[model samples]
Target: MATSWRTIGFEKNKKLFERAIEGGELGHAYLFSGPEMIGKRTLAVEVANKITNISVPDILMITSAGSESGQTIAIEDIRKIKNFVSIRPYGGAYKFIIIDDAHLMPETSQNSLLKILEEPNASSIIILVTACPEALLPTITSRCQEIQFFPHPRTIMESVLAEAKLSKANKEFLADFADGRLGLVKRIIEEDSFGEIEGAVKKIMYLAKADINERLDAAQKLTDEKNKAGLPRLVLYWMLYLRTRLSEPKAQKMLSGLLALNEIVNKPQYNHRLALENFLISL
Candidate 1:
């Protein structure tokens, strides 16, 4: 039988799980921290499945409201689990609550959750998983057994790409741009759209040389396709790339423009297209 804590390509974590099983030192509250898509949630859920004696598919996966909702574990969802936690385990040794992207929880929610962590029910185990653990409350962090997950070895990443049946060129591209993130790699493999963003980046750079009208046109095109939330990130990366390519004075100007653009993009009332157009024109 496949164990719930068995994580793919996580040899070190697997050993840790084995040791926990051997020593009977299973924790009631665990904080699993790692880069996005490095399998922190996967491992957490696997452990939860094991403790609950439930099939992985039967595990209730709840999330927040947004495009990234599937990944955002919300506080309302957490509250729903409180009653469940109060009860005894249904079929297994414990009832497990795996909170993915726990850092996304609001301060109010975290405070609400602190009470549960402070005095957890005997049969309940809370597992908080996040890429940005620093965003979580220190009090919450103090109450949990922390586990760190690192990126898989390059060899392991290469093997995973190979198994996905990607061409050599695409595999190299994914490996270079994935930032040690398996979720990013999986996205590239599934959508085959990674290069589209690069093309958009190139267009933005090209616009810097064109007239204001051309720049505005390019900005509108890029923002329309990528959305307001994503445009600043692309511009930020482009600015970093330009800094390396241009003279010091030119780079400084571009960096300042980027900072200004960032400020505009962050404003709730700013029109994304207009802000992007102004930034592109200034560039």
Candidate 2:
């Protein structure tokens, strides 16, 4: 019944949206940009919910892309949004079109979105959420009001974990390991899928010191599809692990290698095994 952003940790973004809503200056389109799992999508949804008076779950026009969507927001997705925007609101005065991972839209699809942005829709709001806004066209970004989300402060994250009623050990693990991503913490806690990452983080040190055979063994083990699901999390934890070792001379180089490998693994056409092996052996 009330418009609230308790689910998001970014205070500035909350205030910004609140102001826009209160002033009746809410824009026709907005771009929400931030790091992965840093709450861009959450804030985008909340903004849409507030403006359209549509209960969060009932907002049928919302769209999101993921690995299953082939990692790109296709032209068909844009077409659906175009159709949604053309329709009038069912119950409320406003309707919404929220697209997550908007940057994943290739140039052509982005052009389709551009057509919508250029044509004014009085009753519709479009929100584009992405971790990689650079992948989107400059014109698309220029058409929308851009809002940036950032990692939650450590104090805020700690308070959130404390309220989750986790065990002391688990609480501490999340506190040290969350890296300001509450989404990641929740996923790891609820799914119990983080064990592989924990082990991998510990093994990173060993892998760094490991010889050719050990490195090759790790590369082989890590390249499986079953294990690939966990690689992103593992790389994330590895980056956090590197944070602690920044005092060492090789820390930057190690992190650079991991970042490069991460980029490769995220692309559909890249060879995950070769990238993993290259990073491991180089370490």
Candidate 3:
């Protein structure tokens, strides 16, 4: 049977796993950091399984002190864990706590957790997983052994896509648009949302090439679809496309316009329709 942690290609982290398995050098606390959907939590869970030898259960597990059933890890959840750590393990040699989305833990909660890290219980391990490690407090980070996970290469991504039985055309588009995020590829394939997004992109491109009102209309539609993020992304792509097909001065103007529009959309108070209208008028 395939091991849980071994499923996501941890060859590069093999040494770390081996050391942990060997037992003596295992750290009391670990921070697993990587982009979202890159299997950080999977590795953490595998480690927990190996340590606890607990039969895999579908329950939501957390490390916080006060979390009720179904609640994600909260400050109270961390508080609840302190009592468990003081006790000895019943089944396995070690007790493991896997904290998912540790970066989302508030400062007070993280600070509360720091005390446990500073004086870790023997035979207990805490694994913290997060997509944005930098957002975590320095004190908490400094107390834990950090492991960083990088995106898989294109070749590996292609292999994963093949295993999923995705169409070749869809796979290529996903590979380009997902920025090596396998999670995104899985979502796109499962939902079959690529065609809709592609149609929207094409419509926006056509509008960009038409009159100012057309561009404004396209922007409004984009915002309506909750694709505000895609607006700047598409504009950048369109500007580059135009650069390849137009003179230097025209390309420069397009780049400047795209950049201005990007800034407008990025503003927290941006009036989407008004901003789009202004951008269209400028174009």
Candidate 4:
């Protein structure tokens, strides 16, 4: 496979980076934001690989996965970036650092990251890859150049489906659910009925009918081990639902609250479970 963003329908983004790189105009910080299962991280790695093709030991790949399960990146992890940047780059090339799930950095971690952003070393290049750019602080975002990605067009998505071995209905299910997320389409093909996303739709009716106590109980259940990564899907579904119902007087408030709660959930410093409980009660 070709090792470039163009490999994943991100030709424009690849060109943008290429121009900056060839012109020697690359910025100190970059924010790569896009929908989940898209190629944000893939492109970041491609950029790094292109620049540091030969022997290089300074690149750092950080993910919230290193933290305790279900928790965001801690202040301690941010310190690694601080320490990593203090050293000058080897052979005068940039010291590349990519932080996947950038939104998972708690407030304290972000503040710590801000210090590095404010006083960026000319030898360092930081790339923050995230699906939720809004979860990051404005000060942090303002310091970085942004590259946005979107889903592939309908024609492109349909073309991909043409190669699948699925039955007509199964193919349609992947088409509707993946909605141009190529990564998601691959996942659905591999996991089928075990895809957690299928469960997000089943909760809308339960959420609507449940009382405060029932909702609170539901919130507790949602925080269990199984739902670790599915929370984003749930939030996205509610946000979309709330947007369509904005004409309803109460829906506006609900939307605002949900948005605020979503931000809190990104920062592990907050009591995310309580936030979910409060959000359910308000609903």
Candidate 5:
């Protein structure tokens, strides 16, 4: 599904690209780095939208999957990008490739991508999106135009939450409670059973103090409550929870491990139960 510039939360980012379009200064490659689910991916597609005349051309999206599903990005994925952009556009100005969770790429994949970045084709643009930019190689980061996405301020978040159909009081509470993640806020609106992430965080605190057996039980219990498809969003909830408390030394430590855990969860072949157990056991 395509998203409009007005639909996503990043009006400023939309305008930035619009200016770039007018000035004809768009780069061949870009890096959209920020927290998980904060409209980074949406904005990347929207940048494509600005030039596509609402008829989005072949905008290839590369992302992670389980080992059975080709695992994370491989050298072959880069080859696909090479083949995709090499073709001359029939109508559109350029081809676009948006790589979601690009930081999950293995070293081989990253090295393969570097070749594309070094001699980018003018007829195509690549956008690499990730929550953990630090995980990407420095060479990869240095070659692209890095755009940093941040959480929305309270007032802006309130407007984004308006689509949830909540009352004034409920909206205000969620605006602050969500801690500026537009994606988390949108999830609560779209999923009736999603529950409050704050409640999930509270459970995390309790689990942290529990016995190993109890903590392990809690991990399965949580996963069982949601279908496997929800795992990525579930991971984002925990990430956002830890992200809000980065000033705390303990949370800062937990977030580092959470990032590595995040990389594997999207892969269907990975054992999510054991992964969650390990996280809780380490606590």
Candidate 6:
């Protein structure tokens, strides 16, 4: 298969696109949505190369210029792609435009891209990659075929960790801490503090099972002003822990709380500290 370059654990996604190609039903634009480091960009690039039969880096690749601290995909970037796609492919069946972290494109940039999607060139393909699709306009999503990437299965994660020569004990710990997010696991391991983080998570898990006052005290400490930067990581660890406890009926009851906590942390308007504290205290 042309998309064989896709990383492990994306076989199903590769097959889906393969089937689309076989049926001559491959869409002009595709939205690849998922958590960070789940192979969305790799799959998108591989699929683009396959469909275009082009391997030229500069001619076929169009990447978004965005940053974590709120730099967005600008209108100028979209205009460049708009003009590029209008031209015929240099030496391929299709021209490819990939917008990484596309959800960060400001509303104006999204609107600008919408125009291109509306009048897509016959020999061009656009792929939008994002972790948070809800941030994108509905019109943009509605116009493109959506592909979702999820966390890898435990078996695949274990294989990847093994390839990296991680110890068996560390592999088991990361497999749980990452909740199937291979990129996160890799990052944690490279940081040399995975053991410390793991220990802290275990202590938090114990607090989750403790009495109300004890839980509240722990939450207060976790959400302390100076420790604010770590709150998100703390919440993520708890979510991973909660995932394992889902088989328990009592744990199942906290799903709503988890969702609420996740929402509060993601949105800036909410007092995330208070929200997290309330959720943890309740647990």
User: RMSD of each candidate?
Assistant: 5.6, 3.2, 7.2, 4.2, 4.8, 4.8
Q: Which candidate do you rate higher for lDDT, 3 or 5?
A: 5
- lDDT of model 6 at position 132: 74
Candidate 2, residues 253-279: lDDT per residue as tens digits?
998898787666554346778889989
Residue-by-residue lDDT tens digits, candidate 6, 65-163 = 332323356777788887787677866667888888786577888899999999988888888987778878899999999999998998988887887
Candidate 3: how many backbone clashes? 9
Per-residue lDDT of 1-283 in model 1, one digit per residue for the tens?
Answer: 2443446777777667667756777787889897667777777776666656674433445444432423234557767767767666667667777777677676767887898898887777788887668778899999998989887777767878888777788787666556466765776568776576577557656776899888877777766744645665476455545545556676677777776665545333356678777777787
Evaluated at residue 232, the lDDT of candidate 5 is 67
Error of 4 at 237 (Å): 6.2
TM-score-better candidate, 5 vs 6: 5
- Taking the candidates one at a time, how many backbone clashes does each contain? 0, 0, 9, 0, 1, 0
Give the range where candidate 3 is weakest over 10 consecutive residues by summed lDDT: 63-72
Question: Residue pairs in steric clash, candidate 6?
Answer: none
TM-score of each: 0.71, 0.83, 0.64, 0.78, 0.77, 0.70
Model 1 regions lying over 4 Å from their true place:
1-6, 55-60, 66-74, 203-283
Say which prediction, candidate 4 or candidate 5, comes out ahead on lDDT: 4
Candidate 4 weakest ten by summed lDDT: 193-202
User: Compared with the true structure, what per-residue lDDT tens digits does model 4 show for residues 108-133?
Assistant: 88999999999988888999998889
Clashing pairs in 1: none
What digit string (tens of lDDT, one per residue) describes model 3 on residues 1-283? 1233554565667567766577568888889887656677777776677667763431225732344422235667778668777777877667788888676576777888888898998878888887667667899999888998887677877888877776778777666656566655666678786675666456545665798666766667767646654554455445434544455675566557765665555332356567667766665
Worst 10 residues of 2 by lDDT: 57-66
What Cα-based lDDT does every candidate model obtain?
A: 0.68, 0.75, 0.66, 0.77, 0.76, 0.74
User: Candidate 1 local accuracy as lDDT?
Assistant: 0.68
Best by lDDT: 4
lDDT, residue 283, candidate 4: 67
Q: Name model 6 segments beyond 4 Å from true.
A: 1-3, 58-71, 189-238, 241-258, 261-283
